[model samples]
Target: MRDKLLMAYRSIRERRTRSILTVLGIAVGIAAIVSLMSVGYGMEEAITGELTGYADFIGVFPAKITGTTYVELGSFTDRDLKDVQRIGGIKEFSAMTFDSAEVEYRNKRVPIFFISGDTKELESMYVEPVGLKEGRWLRENDYKGCVIGDRVANDYFDEVVHVNDKLIINGEKFIVVGVFEKASTLYASDIDPYIFLTLRATKEALQTDEINYIMVRVYDIEEAEEIAEEIKEAINDNHGLDDFANAMTMGSMIEMMGDVFNIIRGVLVGIAAIALVVASIGIMNTMLMSVMERTHEIGVMKAIGAKSSDVLSLFLLESSMVSLVGGVVGCVLGAVAAKVISLGAGTALGIEFGAVVKPEVLLGGMVVAMVVGVLAGFYPARKASRMSPVEAVRHE
Candidate 1:
């Protein structure tokens, strides 16, 4: 076996150019599969982590009312909150209203998405306090102060708005109590380009009592699905219609994201596999050429009482070795490619893209490459083993 491997290695070294090109072809395919699949798995974990960070959290939104646009649809009411509070397994609930306004700072004005809610309740729902770029979050009793998003404080104004700077919004002056550090997430949420104010303050400014949405935290995350259903039914029953409101749980959102990625990964892997098929054909062609070139060598081995199986194994080993080396190189290239992609995307979009390569994915890629090599070399190896010693010796 050692002698056969050495002979195989020597043959590859003899035809260095052809061997290198063929290995590169296989490497391209394996690299595509590895990088794409790694990014897919990494995205799944990143998104799921963000969603579950606010454990057992559910968002309740006003549903389609059939005859009105989404903007004109009925908003969450005080009664809905009362009903949801009565539901079992719910730990706490908070009412929030979302609005957009042109915020004016001295000579500059910028539009911002703002949330009006209980400061204490918002704090409880979040994993941690809004990391401040400047000052601090809203105190429970504060009514005229607001915390600004990172963009609002840093980029939105003509000058950087500092802590204690007063901003005018909707003809109302609000002191900048804090500034969010920066927004980073795959999905757009209240974190980016948003301002937070006390519920009473916004309610007074808007001159309306309607709530835009509600967030509920459940005691047990495992029972979130059932709790969500109960909340939805309760709201619908109170309004006397199924389409009046919609409830979404963290688990369902995560599962939906998982399903979407699974489809994407499947399609990307299929495309990569096509490249592998092309590489497999290249391997077969190379093996056939090698068999023809070494016809006399094969004949001599057979004449010296070497079995056909021995000849076949030698050829198979050579092809498999080529693919194995390609697989290793491909993995390195794939990891570097994944990292480059992640960095570029994160810088451009401000979303975290962690490229994760699992142990199974690495092992699976190499194993698949070896299997393809063995199959590609089979016919050529068989033909070489079956050549007649007399004919092969007489031929040029």
Candidate 2:
């Protein structure tokens, strides 16, 4: 065993540049798999945080709108909010109406997702955002006062409105009272412009009583799902209902995020996986070439009381050593690359995502490399074992 290892080591050392190149090729692939996966996982984390920031604001998408495209989904009704609040054990709830809108401040016009919420749920649910670069947040009964996110307020409205001025949304004037601090998507970390208003005012502006989402908070966080179910049933039974609204507790939304993020992480990892497969191909090629070059040596070793199994073990050991070393190099390189990618993209996205190669990914890479080495060496090892000593020695 020692002799085989020594021989394997010597062979690789003799062809220093070739061995290094071969290992490096595999390292590049390994690094990609490890680093990209880590980054993907980090992105998923960032997005989850961004989406769930409003702990109490349960998203209320129109429940499986019958026979409609994602683009054609209908809005929820105000009665839907009333129905949900009517359920027993349900404490408080609020509704939001959203539309793509253009806000005009003097000569400047900016487009954003027009979102409106009534009551203190905007702040109480943390939907108002935590940080404000300037001014205060939306106050109840300050009917005309509205708050805009940092990006929207500064870049667009700041020029016209100071603290107590009005801006126009679809020709309807609204007072710019407060500005929110910089906020990222706690769920996606993707920047989106969300402009808020009073539900009543927003409904009037849109010329309808329709709401796009309803946020519900129940007694005891654990009862969120049960309360949501009861709400759903109540909506179905409501006699005056035209199209029923969908109710969701926070738990269901969070659970949906888990499945969603897992798929995203898997996709990112899969892209990197293709690169690793190419590296494995390179490993296999190198092993086959090594076998061909050492035909005479293999024959001589076999003639000198070395069994076919010994010949197989020697080549397998060589491939394993090469891949093992390459795997380590790849892991380190990949982690550094992930960090660089994270810093460049994550920062731009306003997310402080850190690149961390999970232990499982690292270990998995090593195990895969070793297995690939052994598998790649199989045919060559068998070929070396079957050669006749006389035929090999006389050939070259």
Q: Which candidate ranks first by lDDT, i.e. highest?
A: 1
Instruction: Report, for all candidates in order, the number of backbone clashes.
Output: 0, 10
lDDT of 2 by residue, 1-396 (tens): 788789999998987888898789778878878888788776766655655554454455565543223332466555656767777765677777667777888778887776677657766644444555557766656556677765666666557345666777777778777766656544422223566677666666656566667777666676767777776666655534533546655565666767776787788768767877787777778878877788878778777888878888888888888888988998888888888998988668775667666899889877777776677667777777777877765555
TM-score of 2: 0.88
lDDT of 2 at 261: 66
What C-alpha lDDT, on a 0 to 100 scale, does residue 260 get in candidate 1?
A: 85
lDDT of 2: 0.70
Per-prediction TM-score: 0.87, 0.88
lDDT of each: 0.82, 0.70
Instruction: Name the Cα RMSD for model 2.
Output: 3.1
RMSD of each: 3.5, 3.1
Please report the candidate that would top TM-score against the real structure. 2
